[model samples]
Target: MAELPIEIALDDERATQRLGQDLALALRPGDCLALRGDLGAGKSTLARALIRCIAADPGLEVPSPTFTLVQSYDLRIPIAHFDLYRIADPDELVELGLDEALGDGAVLIEWPEHAGDALPSGRILIEIDEGPEDSRKVRLNGPDQAMQRIRRSLAIRAFLGAAGHDDADRQFLQGDASTRTYEAVTTAGGERLILMDAPKRLIGPVLRDGKRYAQIAHVAEDIRPFVAIGSFLRDNGFRAPEILARDLDTGFLLLEDLGRGGILDDQGLPVTARWEAAIDCLVALHRTDVPRHITIQDGTAHTIPPFDREAMLIEVDLYLSWYLPHKLGAEPSPRLREKFHAGWNGLIDRLENASKSLVLRDFHSPNILWQADRAGIERIGLIDFQDAMIGPAAYDVASLVQDARVAVEPVLRDRLVARYEHARRRDPDFDPVPFREALAIMECQRATKILGIFVRLKKRDGKPGYLRHLPRIEAYLRRTLAHPVLHPLHDCYTEAGITPSES
Candidate 1:
């Protein structure tokens, strides 16, 4: 690939540091940066800034590696900082573990000239020089791919600047199981916000009626749904993040920083009070008459799709397509497949006629934040609802009581169900028997679908961590399918040789 060179002028130390931080966003494991500059140049300063940004630690102490020759950091990705000034010969590089460092993680090397022919190809080269008025000038040269990443990083910097947060310190935040990424931005004035980098969803292969799986599954393809849903939630006095600024075209949103107070405690167990608050939030949501269609500022109406039979069937079929083959290493026979479909179809028939509400499909622990200062349901901050659908209210209740990632103790789950039932029973139209049945059916369906999804994540996406939750989901499925209404599903599982006891 051809190399592209770009020049940047830094008027002060902050500008140089900002450039380093921006560059850090584009870096990945195995990438290398060769720093070239004269004595007393800003090479160490820029390297320190880059390391700290990648580590998400602003106050990290990064001493010059002048004496040690090399210093490594355990950032989100491992990084090695090498000051090669002390090296007498290029052959000495191997003795300093440079080759091993380059293989394991990214490296930032100062005085690349001393390395001679030991320098690798495709590495980014940055040269710093003294400029007029005590300023600094930086020239970057790298391969096409690296240059492209740098361009994107620069674009993000410009976007933040245009949003009136020019000097915000960016720190990488945990992303969801989607293409979306996030960064926590802290401004110069100490204001914190979340920067969402959700690019437009790529259209996948046509599934049904020429619609992609994303469309058929009711996944949000852009930021419009999130903005509309968030507005709707806030309008109804819920604790959705307040939008600070947005570039809809770029699919970037600057939102209020909902603090990291999750429903789970440090031991990965549920907090009773927080869980109760979450139940209250769901009760309030289900009681409200949410419109299927909502109008945003542009006057275009965004409609929440129904959890129709086709969508539900496609979701449940993930088990046959991914989980069974991947986990059990056995394909279901035609008879078993037919029975599975027949069972789910029968359950779907019951759900189609049930009372419907806004179903936040993933109303579990990870997506919920606890805000103690707030009162009642408002204290439960909601996130990850862009894929919300109009579905049976019991679906969300099942999701909450039988969380996929964490274990909700059997007793606590029963208590939550009782609390939810009590709240819903207050409505004149609510029927206890049907609600309980629907919750059980939905629980079984969710577990079945997640079994496939977790397997798919391991096989297709190379994420094996999700596999650990399979046993938990299996246990939930067994408990739910024990309901008399799910007898057909239990039979199907037995025929397919996937009994919960084996899992």
Candidate 2:
């Protein structure tokens, strides 16, 4: 299909490099970029800039492939740079393993006319022409889908320019399991910040009451909730990252880069001191009366959603829908599904009447950072709270103690629980028994939901890595099921053959 051509003016070498960086964001493996230009038309410079941006190494040596014909980089996504100026025949392109390189990774080919019509039809074609002074006119043409991605990337570049950080160097950061991605932006003066590229979440198929699961589960669709909640946490003395600038509609944010210091040690094990500090931070947050509605700028108030019954049921249903079918090779009978639902309904009903607090749904090691320079709970930096909801206070405690990703030793879990309870007891209204029961219930619920989620991620999303954590989550389920109050849910698990022993 034909694509609408995009014309960009490169005023100098810097503009050429910036355009290369913008184009890099839209490219993926298996894509080919065909560069058509003369010897001094700045093709090599643009190719070098694109390679360095993809590699996230500004100083990477990207010598022209004029002599070698092709040079490959071991980037996060491998890329091959090809200079076809010396090719004598179209078949010579095949002799140089061009086909294999295009299959394995992205290809950037200069002087593509040397190959005649050997180039792929859908590949991006960029033509450069000499312009006034040191300027160049760059014309981009590609498939409709590729051009759409390039357009969005150009919009993101414009957003950065308006924020006065268009000249900052961007380095890719390790992203989480969600659709959101992050980059570390550093200015020329050594100032650093984080750029969050979170597109508005696409609502899934309508499930119940014409609403999708994200709506039921209180998932944040944009950056508004993060901005509001981060402000609330920072105002309450916690270390949520400050939002410097935001494009709420696009879900793009420039935020303070909370450094890499975290509660986990170098070996990825939990550090006792940091974990203790995180527990103190949670206690401090829960002790206060946090508002459900936060007033954002422009007098817009973002209201925190309640962890209602529909949401809890939809989460736990993952066990029957995904885990049971994938692991057991059979769907649960209607009787079993009804039993599971009834069992959870009772627990969630009780939880609704319990003391409510702001529950950061993922208060685990992955989201908690350590700010050692700060004192007390202030040393704990919080993140990934965009899914925050008004829920039973015990839910976040359960999330911390029985982390889905990290193994919290049983002894340490007990110690942290005791510490949290001790801190809460300072208030006369606090009671230990109900809190313990709530914790046990939440643990069981979270484990059950995660079992289904991990399986769905593997079967539906083709991400099998998450399946490795099933045993740990199953063990957590067993521990919680041992609680006398969770016996009915335990029976449901046994009946469905989802118990740890069965696995």
Q: Which stretches of candidate 2 lie over 4 Å from their true place?
A: 1-3, 92-103, 495-503
How much lDDT does each candidate structure score? Answer: 0.87, 0.85
lDDT of 1 by residue, 1-503 (tens): 56569888889888889988988988877788999999868998899999999988888999999999999997787999998998999998898888888888899999998999898887899999988765899999988888877877777788899989888888788767777888889999999899888888855589779888788888888888898899999999899999988888778889998999999999999998899889999989988888879987667789989988888888898889888787557897798799889998898888866878999899999999999899988999998899999999999999999999899888999999899888888798788899988898888888888998888878877678999998888788777867888888777665544464311
Clashing pairs in 1: none
The TM-score of predicted model 2 comes to 0.93
Model 1, runs deviating above 4 Å: 1-6, 88-92, 116-120, 141-145, 491-503
lDDT by residue for model 2 (356-412), tens? 789989999889988878898779888799889988888888999998898887788
List pairs with backbone clashes in candidate 2.
none
Which is the leading candidate under TM-score? 2
